[model samples]
Target: MLLLLDTANLEDIKKGIDLYPIEGVTTNPSIIARENTNFLSRICDIKDTIGSGRMLHVQTVGLKADDIVREGVYLNQLMGDNFYVKIPVIPEGIKAMKVLKSMGVATTATAIFTPQQVVMAARAGASYAAPYINRIDNIIGDGVKVVEDISRIISTHNLDIKVLGASFKNTEQIHKACLAGAHTITAPLDLVETLVNHPLTGASVEKFSIEWESVYGKKLTYDF
Candidate 1:
């Protein structure tokens, strides 16, 4: 499973890129516009930081297929190839996804609330389908079930599209997504760290600290 970082603040993004050991990033308009005004510059910086290693998923905001395709091409030009274009799950979005995919741009059909929507995106030749787990839970509990069901549908149909579990609010959702066999899951850095570490790790650290102090003075470490 690929771990996708959720924030786009430059320094925070760089930290996530360097320290989190993740697969890549996912940025929406809300995330990017939160701090910056230079969309092209910021996107290029992120792509450069990621270099040729990871996938950067970016959401495009537009009402038409041509508009979204333009955005995708601009992003492809600004960033390099390892970019995943995120399109909404509307009629125009499906069209845009097909065009973008045919043009060799990886397309992620976002805002997927229903398994039927997932089917449509797959039919449209999308590379990935994002189901907002937190939003699904906000409407009806058991958001993980959605991922599980979608995973089953995609697998049963043997479709080429992958399920990208997003909008995760906690490690539980991340855990459930992993258990449900999602192809990729994106989360904030805090949640990613929380999942990478467990309570057992904390308990072990605390226990080791106590034992170390008993045998010798407390040890300190600071490394870059």
Candidate 2:
């Protein structure tokens, strides 16, 4: 499964990249607004930091179909060809998605809550459908089941779309999403760091290092 960082903070993003094999960064208006800086310059700086080859998913705030499409196109022009324009899964958003898909732009359907929405977004030609896992669990208590159902639907219908699970509160939710067949997940940096660490793993590594140093006089394995 692919992993992406759901943040726009450059410092966290740089650290995330240095620490993990992050495929890209995903951002909504709230994330962008937190910087409280020039929008274009901030996005451009993000593009520069992540480099041109990585995927950058940016959401559109437009509420109308036409306006959403326009904003998506504009964002594409601003970011570059590799950018994925994220739209909501509302009626207007689906319409905008169709229009954007016809124009050959990579699109992601966001704010999804069910398998039906995932199927709708895929039918509307979204390259990825993002389901809010923690939000769904907060309201209904079966977020992982929803992701699994979406995954089953994708496989049963042979849809050319992937589930992008988001809004995670912890690494266990991430693990459930993956086991439920989410093709990708976008999470905060803290959770991403958690994914790489465990008490046993750290203790084992420390023990191994101590034993090695006892014999090698503080030399790293590579130095030998």
Candidate 3:
């Protein structure tokens, strides 16, 4: 599964990229606004930090098909071919996806809450479909099951799109999403850090360190 950081903080992005095998970074308008910087400059900085080879998913703020297409084109021109324009799975977004597809621009359907939305977006030529995991669960729906159903439907119908699960509250949700067949997941930095952190692992390392210190009189490996 592809792991992505869902944040616009430069420090977090740098730290995440340095600490993990991050495939890319995903950002929405809210995330961009939180940084309180010029949109173009901030996005440019993020693209530079991640480099051109990694995927960068940016969302469009337009609500109409023509506006969405225009925004998608503008972002594509700004970010290059590795960019995936994130559009909502509404009617206008589906229409915009079709237009963007014809223009050879990649699209990711966002704000998805149902399997049918993914199917429609895929049919509209979106390369990826993002489902809000915790949001679904907040509404009393099974988020992981939705992802599993979406994956099953895609495989059964042979769709060419991937399920990119988003809006996670904890590492367990991410874990369940991946096991449910989500091809990718984007999460905040804290949740990402917790993924590999376990008390037992820390305890084991400490135990080993104590054993070594007891034998070596607190000497470094290089000193020995």
TM-score top scorer = 3
Query: Which model, 1 or 3, shows the larger lDDT?
Result: 3
Instruction: Candidate 3: give the clashing pairs.
Output: none
Off by over 4 Å in 3: 222-224
User: How many Å off is the CA of 163 in candidate 1?
Assistant: 0.8
Count of backbone collisions within predicted model 1 = 0
Summarize candidate 3's per-residue lDDT along 162-217 as a digit string, tens digits. 99999999988999999999999999888999999999999999999999989987
Candidate 1 is scored at a TM of 0.91
RMSD values, in order shown:
3.1, 1.6, 1.3
Which regions of candidate 2 deviate over 4 angstroms? 219-224
RMSD, candidate 2, Å = 1.6
Q: Candidate 1: RMSD over Cα atoms?
A: 3.1
Q: Which of the two candidates, 2 or 3, achieves a greater TM-score against the reference? A: 3
* lDDT for 82 (candidate 3): 84
Query: Which one wins by TM-score: 1 or 2?
Result: 2
Worst 10 residues of 3 by lDDT: 215-224
The predicted structure with the larger lDDT, 1 or 2, is 2
| Candidate 1 lDDT (Cα, 0 to 1) | 0.86
As for candidate 2, its clashing pairs are none
